[model samples]
Target: MTQISAGERDRADTLASRRDKFILPDGVIYLDGNSLGPVSHTAISRINHAVTHEWAAGLVRSWNSAGWMDLPITLGNRLAPLIGAPADTVIVTDTLTILIAKLLANALALRPDRHVIVTDSDNFHSDFYIADGVAAATRRDITVRRTTRAALAEALDDDVAVVLLTHVDYRTGELLDMADMSALVHAHGALMIWDLAHSTGAVPLHVHEHGADFAAGCGYKYLNGGPGAPAFAYVAPQWLDSLTNFLPGWLGHARPFDFEPTFEKAPGIRALVTSSPSVVGLSALAGALDVFEGISLDVLRRKSLALTDFFITEVEERLPGVFELVTPREHHRRASQVSWRHDEAYGIVQALIARGVIGDFRAPNIARFGFTPLYLSFRDVDVAVSHLVEVMHHREYDDPAFRQKNPVT
Candidate 1:
């Protein structure tokens, strides 16, 4: 492989200066942003202020004074530009699974005549679980199709009500064409609901431009919010009034504080919110988003491609036949991460983590590495590859300690 010096690569990166904004640890090269992003210094400060001043001192009055009630809308507006959705159409609320369940229910309601919900076989497992649970409860049919972009198109038919898919595959980091898929679904008179769990904040998205009917994603991943951070949901303006929310909590009421006997849905996307917003988590996510204030999504995409390209090149040259590249080679068909298939994928991931190079292991035989342009440097990628070489040469992955699986991984 043709080696590119870190200095040369860093000099070309417009996002290099943005690294200081995050609170990453020393002596570690983190390649797991797709799993959970490291917290930013701004997020830490925001949490402190929310807890110490807003919650502790302001008491209940803070609900109005601190704009706590509007946190969901406020953060949604901030996140709109990143996902290419319009104002008032997006809201930060609930976990990804909850939002997915709600969106699927609403989508099915929209197409009551259609009985089938089509999804990829390799899409996130939680998404499949949510769909299966909803189908079982509502007596709907679900078709699990292949993961290829072409296979998805073939699986669509008049019977399909909703085509649910992860924008980027979690294990392989394969990016599906949103615009094309949405158009196909619409042509079949079916709505498209994209799970942006592995795509948002890591890649440039156009939810509205791509004609997505509904979308959902987590804040804890590339958004850099704390663990179990509140997730986001999006509904197109046209469906805001037509779609029905399954879990219509009080906050989603048109007049939530009115204590009315009837449940009146709020106007626009606000009606999708099920319960009270997590003020602390929203505050932290707001701070995390501040880092993207002046940054361009175009620049982020370019840097992400460069980082992954460099890592793939290095791995191929250093460890010839040791691993198989699973992520797509084309930039447009790839997300902000890369993956490899090997028999000892789990042990290899453990060995790398032990060496202070963090990546993740998927079931059976896949090792994944994520690249965040905002905080990662080109040098970090080079060092991570070097550590992998050391681990392989030393046969450290064969150690008995690495064979033991952890609860989380």
Candidate 2:
């Protein structure tokens, strides 16, 4: 195998300067951005301003004076371009689970005649749970249907009101063709909803371009928002007018301040807003979007593919037959992460974390690693693989302490 110079590749990287914007810990290589991204100077600074000035000084007046009420839509507009959504089409709001339930319920309203909601069997577990909850809320008027990704295309029937799927498989890091899948669902008169938690920031997304009826994603992952940060949702232009919020709040009222007795929903995506926004979380998320201001998803994707490809190539060359590659090798079919299946995957992940290389373990037998182009470099990837090589050959993961599983993993 030819020796690779990660230093040289990093030095030539145009996004190298973006790394300085983040505050990565010393001597640690972070490879779990898919779970939670590291903090950026911009996000920290923004959060501090919100605490010190907006909330502390302004108090109640801040709702109007500090523009606290508009963070959901305002911040969402900032996130719109990155996801290839039109202005005013996206709104930052509750957790992905809540958004899924709200969107799934609203889909039933759209297709009053339909009685089923179809989703992939491999979708994030929470998504399936939310869909079931939505179905149950209808007094069994609706049924939650599950199908494998390979079989999803043929599963839609007249009773299917919505088809919910994760754009990228959480455990395997496999990406699906958004345009083709969404189109297929529409042909059968069912709404399409996508959970983009894994691909929102690292992969190039075109929600509107792909004709998805609704899309939602988390901010804590590739967006670099802190933990429990607010999530975002997008509604297609055509649906913005006809859609109804399943969980409505005062803020979604046409005249929330009017204090009218009857419920009158606000126009456009604002109708999707439920309850008061998470001011601090939204503030941090808005701050995180600052990092992607002028950055192109296309450029980020190029670097991401390069990093993952390098890691895969090095692993195959050095440790043949050691682990089963779970992520797809094809660029178009891959997300911004990689995973490998091993009998001792949990131990390997713990061992890597003990050595300052942070990755996460998925249930059963998969070890996952995420790549964020905004703050990571070729050198980071190179070092992480080196640690894995040592951990495997030196049997560092054999320590009994690593066998104890944590609650969060």
Candidate 3:
């Protein structure tokens, strides 16, 4: 059913030569990098060394000798460049939920006189939930405003203490104008906190350049830091001097080991820490980041746009009536993914996976493909399109098993 030619196949085959760097399953077309990136060769080797040699052999000594104690800060410094943040502004720490709580709680502390915490309607659910909890904990009134950019711009008033938003929309892959939004928040005497879960690695970020007061993102998504990987939080350098964390555990204390009776928080980013770093996970993530050693995010962004655009074009031309594109077509307004809306989206996703094209399905009607340029190739994209065409034309997604809802989806 696919009209792809042998020349195109050969070109994709050549492009796949670099795929050896990833530990992907044979015959699988992994289009879920935006969810969880496949492990890299370097990550495996480094994790193995850390588990067998560094931790197993060195034990407690590894904290000081193997530099385990500083992995969070070190990894933060490494990730700073990728996210356009400066050193000491970012700290690799707990899950995104915790990080968001810390950032919001700290931001609220900065503006006790102001009562409102404004956020978009489409923010990731966890962010909204965390903000709700922070409001309850602080006994402060929270106002969530669901509005478009123009709406938000108009709604920005002096009463808003902090403006929260995700840089990229999870479902639609829509990118928000962080710089403009942050400027508007500051102009209204409010701080801005961003959720970067979908933006950090999918595209280039400039927190400092955008004048963001605080930000947080998941480690397992675009960062390719693996499942349950430690997330990161960024506090602007200027706020670092006054930022106060409510979750001040012993690990965050300035003299944690001094057997102090009271909690005296560590200075700067260290104050955000509430627990010891996850050593094994941090080690793996640290190793995985090395893959981007010579890679520029600009190049990554270019390739990402190309891959998503190619997918969109191929889908539109090859299966026009069968699939409906949900992601924005405009390049500047989109992220690194292309999503399609179909009544049988889940079933079609199952069929594609059965045939070895592995994308993901969102709720209701969205089938999502995350095109990670570091491991994806043009040929793989072609092959995926070929499989998709077959599944669509043959009506293979009509299978009952494909329709059954799974717990994970």
Candidate 4:
């Protein structure tokens, strides 16, 4: 790996101009966008307006006047293009966990005869947990089976009802082939569910185009909504009239205000709404998404690849054999982030953060750095790697303070 010309690359980056839209902290090279995207100026403005004007003045009237009641679908439509999904198929609703539960259950409902759900060991923990929980809830002898990505095809069988896989490996930043996987699952006659938590805004996706039966992802990562930002779920329009909403709320009722004794499903994307939309969070997310309105995923992907490639190059040159590069080197098989494996990855992450380079540590031994093309510049990547070089070379992380574990980490 060899470093690219940072000065030249930054001048040529088309997305570099968009960095002004975000309100990143001064003096911090935020490489943790894969975990939690920082707030943008538009997001802040939207949040302020929602707090001061919408909620404070309109009160309950905001549901109708401010379009709060429709945010779940509206925001969903806003995010659809990022994933190459059709407008009516996506809905920003609930947390990723809740959405995962709903999506997996919905797929299971469509395959009652199948007794097994297939997922890889590398899938997000929440996804596996939800799959296991849904299997347990079935009470009809259903089981959740886990395996490696390489064996996903072998894991699938006539008994497999649904297959859930993360588009990007959360810890290793490995990108999976959505089209290939979806086709394989379909060949086996099982519905495919994609957990897009790590790839939603970080990579170019064709969720609906790739024939994914269902999908879910977070809003706080590369999408840049604030912490605790709402998550989204996607249901193929083909199942609009048939998919079951396991956690139905009044909003999902066909005639929400009808208040009928029996539950009636709403039409289209509204069918996925489980409860009232988070007005403030949606407001923030809508504002945050403003920066992405006219952006091209192709352009974004190119910038991401360059940044990661450069970072990996600089690391290999400066740090030598200090850490093992765990993220895939193949551009087609990598996400917008990079990770290195080290025994003291946690301490290394802490040391970098103390120096104002904010990356994150995944469990076990992974130090992760996310590169967001929308706001991150080549200079940012260069500076972050420079700090990492210093931290490792100086043995600054040898201090006991850097080794202490936080509850969150």
lDDT of each: 0.90, 0.90, 0.85, 0.90
Q: Is candidate 1 or candidate 2 better by TM-score?
A: 2
Which residue pairs come into collision in candidate 4?
none
Model 2, residue 33: C-alpha shift (Å): 0.7
1-409 per-residue lDDT for model 2 (tens digits) = 4266788878878999998899999999999989999999999999999999999998989999989999999988999988899999999999888888888877788898889999898888899888888888885588888999889877988889899999999999999999999999999989999899998998989999998899999999999889999999999899989879878889999999999998889999999997998899998998888999888889999999989998888878788899999999999999999999999999999999999999999999999999888888888888888899999998877899999999999
Against the correct fold, how does model 3 do in TM-score?
0.95
Please give the lDDT score at residue 30 for candidate 4: 89
lDDT of 1 by residue, 84-175 (tens): 99998889999999999999999999988988888888888899888888887776555434345568778888888998989999999999
Clashing pairs in 1: none
Error of 1 at 254 (Å): 0.9
Compared with the true structure, what per-residue lDDT tens digits does model 3 show for residues 1-409? 3455435643654234446677889899999988898898888888998999888999998988998877878899999998899998889999999999989888888998888888888777888888888888997776666566568877778778888899988888888888988988899999999999998887999999988999999888877889999999998989998877799888788888896999898988888888888998998898788777777788778878877877888888888787888898998899998889999999999999999899889887999999887888877888899999999999999999888888876
C-alpha displacement of 91 in model 3, angstroms?
0.4
Residue 205 lDDT (model 3): 91
lDDT score, residue 206, model 3? 93
**Whole-model lDDT, candidate 2?**
0.90
Pairs in steric clash, model 2: none
- Candidate 2, residue 253: how far the Cα is off, in Å: 1.0
For model 1, the superposed segments whose C-alpha errors exceed 4 Å read: 1-3, 139-149
TM-score, cand. 4 vs. native: 0.98
